[model samples]
Target: MSASVERWLTLEGLSNVRDVGGLPLRGGGTTRGGVLLRSESLHFCTPGDVEHLVDVFGLKLVLDLRTRREIERDGPTAVARAGVETVALTFIPEDGRELPETDGVDPLVHIYLGYLRNRPDNVVAAVRRLAAVDAGPALVHCAAGKDRTGTLVALVLDAVGVERDAVVADYALSGEQIEAMFRRWTTASGEPMPADLTPHIPRAAAMAEVLATLDAEHGTDGAGGAAGWLLAHGLDEADLEHLRKRLTESS
Candidate 1:
């Protein structure tokens, strides 16, 4: 991995920022550094944070997966103010309440699955931008950067032929940061902390179930998984190929 690429970025106002790089690719090599990133909301990013992302990361695009309501409540983020092109593409609603309750299902898992079944168009659009050649050093973020961002990043990684276990491990990293994120939000907003953060923390099993479900439902000859879902929804073969080439390089 390049010294310039950090697995975790300790920005002034963000807790869950990370470069989605340095993971082992399926056949060989690793994902390219500084090409892709994921994070929690940029809503509270300090000016220094913005400069670091822009100057150091050479960030060009921000794919925000937060609902418009969330943005209305808590943005325009410092990063956006710094002039990086930011696009809002929501994956699901603010919470999982709109989804029908299922017996014996983890609500988070149900919500993650709903993102795929309920909102395929948004998913394709986000993936398209990530695959675009000019979308240099892009970051995808939602409020918590766990559910919506996690699901989308998982799809991108899986589509790019990142190992499945690596994909799940990447998703699970958010769990480690989520508590601190909530606390930071509380400190910033002056709101009382929630008594329990269980609902907000990600469960590795949820992601595992989601990917396994994708493979079972969308897989062609047991291989397609996320790539198949993207193709079925609207992304073309060329975009998938471009995504692989764009995000990965020889180690």
Candidate 2:
């Protein structure tokens, strides 16, 4: 991994917390630092961790992609108590709720595609919220910061012309953190890992396939591309431009 891309923060109570910056853009420049971050749940963050995020990292917005039930069950996050604005934009509708059975696909892939098919508006809204953040950095996250978070981050990076491979690479990085995350969960909950959740491991090839599908659905580059697809769905042009400026460095 490139040094520029390995900017993980060592927080007292968080894991997989890293800045999504310094990624090489398609043309030449790298992503700007301290604007966008992706992480696992902040529900367990201590006061010091909150200080690091607010004072040191300048995190002003917490975009929680976990479902309503997850938030209620987990209670308040450190960010919320620290006065950082936290927005709940669940990527999966009726998440944790009982649903009709559907077969013929990898369950993980099915859930991933469900984010796009079931509630694309939420996805667009999440990006819009990130783009609208003006006070400081925005941290987006889900329960484990892998699937839902990865999908949204991929789209945001794609919208700004970050190389598709680089986006997939970033997504793949989440796989490196899964074992640690599982340990944390098991320790916290005092329960063995559930059989159903075991198969949801992150894979680079899965993300690669997603990007390929995205490119097939929308043009891979230029104005009428992935970003355009977001615009068509709900994201504003100005907001997209703001995100591009916030995340990308000048060449």
Candidate 3:
């Protein structure tokens, strides 16, 4: 297995949980483990999974990207019962399209780009929350942890100077667990996997294209890319710096 896939945490209830740590930064280091993790929704977290997150990971906060309606439909998550503070920052606005209809472009790519173009404010807020000094060892999640979560993770990884390829690789790691995720979801919700989950499976090319587009449209002088996009939106130098220090370790 690839080193990236090894980062997956073995949880009893969740299938797609992985630390964003150990990814190479552009400067010369790896992201620190136990600092930033990404996962699918925690609504199905088993008692053991909750204990593992709380005891083993020392999870201090949860950045829930699921919308309020999703939470209501799925019922409460075990993270709340574990006493972890979950800040719900809905990345896609409530009325936003779940699968953006596009003619010639990857739907995931279109929706990701839409997040950057349409809901930049929400994206910035997620970064600000993650950068908070007190949010120790936080985990971020949406429904599948592939689209909304992946886009947000890409932005955070990029802002911290993580190499673009490494960022994309991490995003694509979700694809490896897509089948398991669907099965887990089906068991929890008592519904079969959606008729067409293929489109939702993450693709490295899609994330790469999105990053390239960010550099094109949001980058300053054709350079900044994700960091530039964040600064352009609302995050300042301090926010980026905090994220870098909190999540990375110099080798």
Off by over 4 Å in 1: 1-6, 93-97
Model 2 TM-score?
0.90
In the range 1-251, model 1's lDDT, one tens digit per residue, is 75334598988888898988888888888998789889998987888999999999999999999888888988588888889999999887555557777678877778888998888899999999999977788999998888899999999998888888889989988888877988898997899999998877788899998988889988886474999999999999999988998999876
Q: In model 1, which residue pairs have backbone atoms overlapping below 3 Å?
A: none
Provide the lDDT at 2 for model 3: 79
Model 3: which ten-residue window has the lowest total lDDT?
A: 215-224
Per-model clash counts, in order, read 0, 0, 0
Least accurate stretch of 10 residues (summed lDDT) in model 2?
219-228
TM-score of each: 0.93, 0.90, 0.92
Clash count, predicted structure 1: 0
**Leading candidate by TM-score:** 1
lDDT of each: 0.88, 0.82, 0.86
Candidate 3: tens digits of C-alpha lDDT, residues 1-251: 97876798999889889999899988799998889889999987999999999999999989888888998888778888768998888876787556556879877688888877777888899999899888788999999898899999998898787888999989998988888888876876799888877776788999999999888877775344988889888898898889888988899
| Candidate 2 residue pairs in backbone clash | none
Q: Please list the residue runs of candidate 2 whose C-alpha ends up more than 4 Å from where it truly belongs after superposition.
A: 1-5, 95-106, 133-135, 193-198, 220-225
Ranking under lDDT, best-scoring first?
Answer: 1, 3, 2
Residue 38 of candidate 2: its Cα lDDT? 95
